[model samples]
Target: MSQQARIDVISGAYGRANRKIEFPKNASGKHESMSDIFGTNVFSIKKMAKSLPKPVFENFRQQLKGGHTLDKVTADAIAHAAKVWALEHNATHFTHWFQPLNDTTAEKHDSFLSLKTTFDNGLAEISALETFSGSELCQSEPDASSFPSGGMRTTFEARGYTVWDTKSPMFIQDGPHGTRVLYVPSVFISYNGEALDEKTVLLRSSSVISKAALDILNLIEPASEDHPRAQNIYTTLGTEQEYFLVDRGLYALRPDLKTTGRTLIGSLPARHQQLEDHYFGKIPTRVLAAMSEVELELAKLGVPIKTRHNEVAPCQFEAAPIFEEAMLAVDHNLITMDVMHRVAHKYKLKCLFHEKPFKGVNGSGKHCNWSLSTDRGENLLSPSSTPETNYRFLLFLVAVLKGVMDHGDLLRTTAASSSNDHRLGAQEAPPAIISVFLGSELTEVLDAIEENRAVDRAVAGTTTTQMRVQGTTLDLKVATLPKLNRDMTDRNRTSPFAFTGNKFEFRAVGSKQSPAFPVTVLNSAVASALLEIKEDLLKQMGDKAVASEEDILAVIRKYITLTKKVRFEGDNYAEEWVKEAEKRGLPNIVKSPEAFKRILAPNNAEMLTRLGVFTQAELESRFHIMNEKYAKEIIIEAQTLWGLLVQHVLPAAFSYRRELSESAAALKQIGAEAAPEMKWLAQLSPLCSDLEDISEELDQLLNEQAPIEDPEKAAEHACYKISPAIEKARELCDKVERLVADKYWPLPKYHEMFSTL
Candidate 1:
């Protein structure tokens, strides 16, 4: 049969199989009482206002919006309302859902049911006071020592606590097997008040950015006829998620995929992405069914997933959503990832979000498209009609450029991870070096501004046109190209950071990571830049005589000059570019530990602390947390490699060697020249030798696992010592996979996983 015929047959079989799977219908129509249903399963502001007394509700709302602390009385009232809401939703349990130092969400559930006797009859009742008390919302004990702590906590200090976060909403999660619970988004911390979770740090960072953005807006366009009271500005994020789906049975057969979330050893399939047929190709029946289920589940939770299509890599796909407030978007992304796993399983598929699930093929990445916007619905990053005209827009643009230039290392650290280490600098993934792609128009504008030359208004309005011939009809219509807008910049696949239309798309984020970390870092850095610009502008304009629009423009022009070195529109992945970046004195901290060290630098520590984005202690804790996580991930990968070699590869190779020996003997006994069989044995012998060498290396790495005392040193050791050994083992195993008989190979091949679906 032809290849196309075989594909059609496979596709048809999958379509037929999908007919047996039952998917959930949209629940919007079934549930009436829309007003009540809005947050029927959530402990929302409306529920709290109704359940709590008027005075108590007002006090709680003040605390929620004003970022003030909740007193004991207010806490008790809020908890009472939350308990009633959870009970109404059929939730018997509650959990403090927090982001831990491990870079993943964590929770510990406790039942709300308590046995109590009523005056007239024996009955169980949950008290409003108990649910609303400060004690309940403040903290819960968990084993902190087991999580990555970067030497902050030892095995003896196992106590960790989670505190309720008022900024994010509390919602109920419905699960199978009669499990229904309310979850409060919270921040985790050690007993000593040191942050032990990503949420705490992220919350701090968000505040810093918010304040800085407000200050910049106030300075650029302070209350005027066109503008009323100064509006609050917020950082927005739209993370485009990419992943792969393979048959669950095939996925389970591979040890590496099961343990590490990526294939540690695999050879590329012959037909992988060669035809480019899979890129935006027709969706397979089984995959469409799985995606439909995922979208429905995500939509119910208000995820707003807007785009879905096939990606460059076969079996790989992408999903994107419209931009939302950074913090809320991060929360939604976490929920979306969890839902994707559940939905994929229903279709007998497994979703692989790891950055590089397969070697020698395109890896997945989460492109965090970010922008800054005002509460009045204005995108601050957007270029206005007049480049030499829009004074406010120019000020904001210069502030972002300055921030990215001054704190490139901080941005690099945000996207650093063990798995990401393999994905970056390969395929279409961005290189580790951080640079901005502002296209030709913006570059020219900045140059003209620096040279004190007036940028022509007509040049900014000029548009590009392309001749189109559709079905023998020629049309010359005005398409309104990106023009002087930042989107006009050609996208650089190799640059970690690039300006895409009205937002900056951070291409360095890893597939498996929570967008919270990178977005937080970005917000904080940009806030710091805005603060600096505001201070300088205020200083220059303090004299009422000089407080003109030109002064603001002058200050922005100065910023352009200062941040020039950080802007690069060239090839970031090229060796020449690397040399140029080094010559320009930019820090190229590649490894996680090296990049993380910048977080603790004196300038960064003081800047974040003064901005109130992170306390000194919180900043230090994050540095330790990141380093520890990197080390532990490498350790897990190393151990997993050792297991695959001993239990799977060695046994498979020995079995094949025995078969070769038996075949050679049989040929000699038949009085036939066994040269062909002998040559085959010769090829098998070297493979056996390489496998033994790999096994020995893995064993050596495992046996010499001496714990490092220093956090920095430990992370460094993992990157340099442990990672190389793991790579070597993978090399030998991949070789053995190609030579070993398919029946005796022990594990599923890459072709089976990548091509089967």
Candidate 2:
């Protein structure tokens, strides 16, 4: 292609910014306002209350709230309502939406109109009539052979059941493909009821956390500190989604972006988030339009998206929602990501959720703001002024730290993926070492507890210390912006897990990764820690007795002392912290393959199995599945790198080298000065030759046979050898890109992408 043609392609992409597109809507009617459209497609609690009979709705609501099994009568009533509502909204099909082991949702749609016999005229005939019954809604059999099960089910044995999770209300989908789908959130399992998806483990982990929390609550005196003992405790999550957007035209041109979801070999972008001007900056017109569509689409589905802004990278942005129950939040995040992609494409852009699409700037992270709330609206992480509440809060905080201390490797293992490896440990993302940042104010409070120091405001010499960390006021000298109220201490961007005021923000999670596994690991780890604390307290009080207030305080102090190493107040990204973390005995496994190995450890297996999160066999299968996924992903990246280098980069280099050689020879033929051309040829020719040499080396590395039957060994080969060669090939190819002429270069340059959008 000519230089003009490439320029035209980019210009054509930019031209899309001027056009405006309508947001997606249902066929029922046009939506005039958010109130009119909000929850219109969702079969929410409100929808259920209105649609079902009072007693039936109340009993069914209790079942959902209490996590009890639904009776056939209630199931039938709910199914009938759901079918009527779906048909009214023009939905012809429904599917059991489930997250399989691949960290992605899967569904096979079935029509509500089932063919049945009527025998009207004493002749054999088929009749099409609506027939979505309770059994169909409650359970479905989808072929299990295609899904990754780690040998749980043979290819010939393709029987799997999907059961509806009653807690997550049914919702009608929007957009062209979605409009026809009445998506029922569900759990996938094999014929023998082996868990096959992240949701299954998550559901079990949630139960474990809830039960452990209730046990602790039950042990405490009811109605203490003006707070009643909670009947139920649930985990909540406010997931912050981060992504980048590039014009789809440019995305189409780059095979690497399409294949591996990142630029395979491009130079470090010159003008990429360098000045930090893009952070919370003005929204680009095209991006704003895309965000508008995303918001409208999500609003109808009952997703409470509360914030949107320019993130710290060029072409990057973030959208965050209010906290909801953890399971629902996980489902919402998946839906939000999907809706964002669809909306971006509607505006001729491709939403890039890859962790590191460009090399020289900040990578995207989905910061999960996690907390626990009671039935009466008490945030467990929030510090209280009363002695009993404050003590309880501190106890839970200490348990979290202990969990991090004991299970940092497991937490990191949950987040391990080939794509995440590029983002972790640098570029505004977390380091491989996991530590909790409890800010300056919280640090001082913990310090006092650890040292047994009496507080200054010790309630007139009483032992009750006021642990309230006063909120900070941000008075920026701006006219329109109000005087901002902020947390007691400043935010820590470097910490993987940081206490951002009331909740812990897990900032190291990759943008594209699912939160189910991470949340499961976190909740399970915390539960295990809490159980340990309970046991230790009982041992101190008695082998099987509840602790008094004094005894509880002593137990809290002991645990604080034991788990102090997991709390880091300094910069997590600093080199000194890495050394410091090593000294602190923190696990610093940076590679995904090695980090994933921790999941199969005896200690991790025992905790997960004992908590009923996963069985022993299930644990091994997960390890195999993840390692296999990592190996395959790296192979794809390596092969993609090879294709571009051999077919495009090598040819471009040769073209430039030939030009330099011909110029040098032609100058000599003309009997003119040829010193500059010869010098240029001397430089250009060798670099081109070296590019091929590196490409060949990479091919050999990729071609080497490993013990394929051993998934761990195969992943190790990909990680230790193949990945390094791919990087080396990229390094050489990037060097070649510099030598090649702008007109001859076959790939989009970083500067072009960064500067344009």
Q: TM-scores across all candidates?
A: 0.89, 0.94
Give lDDT tens digits, candidate 1, residues 65-169: 675778888887677778777777678788889887665788888877655444535655544422434578666788888776656789999988888888677
- lDDT of all predictions: 0.77, 0.83
The clash count of every prediction, one per candidate, is 3, 0
Question: What residue runs in model 2 are displaced by over 4 Å at the alpha carbon?
Answer: 1-5, 17-31, 177-179, 223-228, 386-389, 456-467, 472-486, 540-547
How much does each candidate deviate from the true structure in C-alpha RMSD? 5.2, 3.3
User: Highest lDDT, which number?
Assistant: 2
Q: Show pairs that collide, candidate 2.
A: none
TM-score of candidate 2 against the unseen true structure: 0.94
Cα-lDDT of candidate 1? 0.77
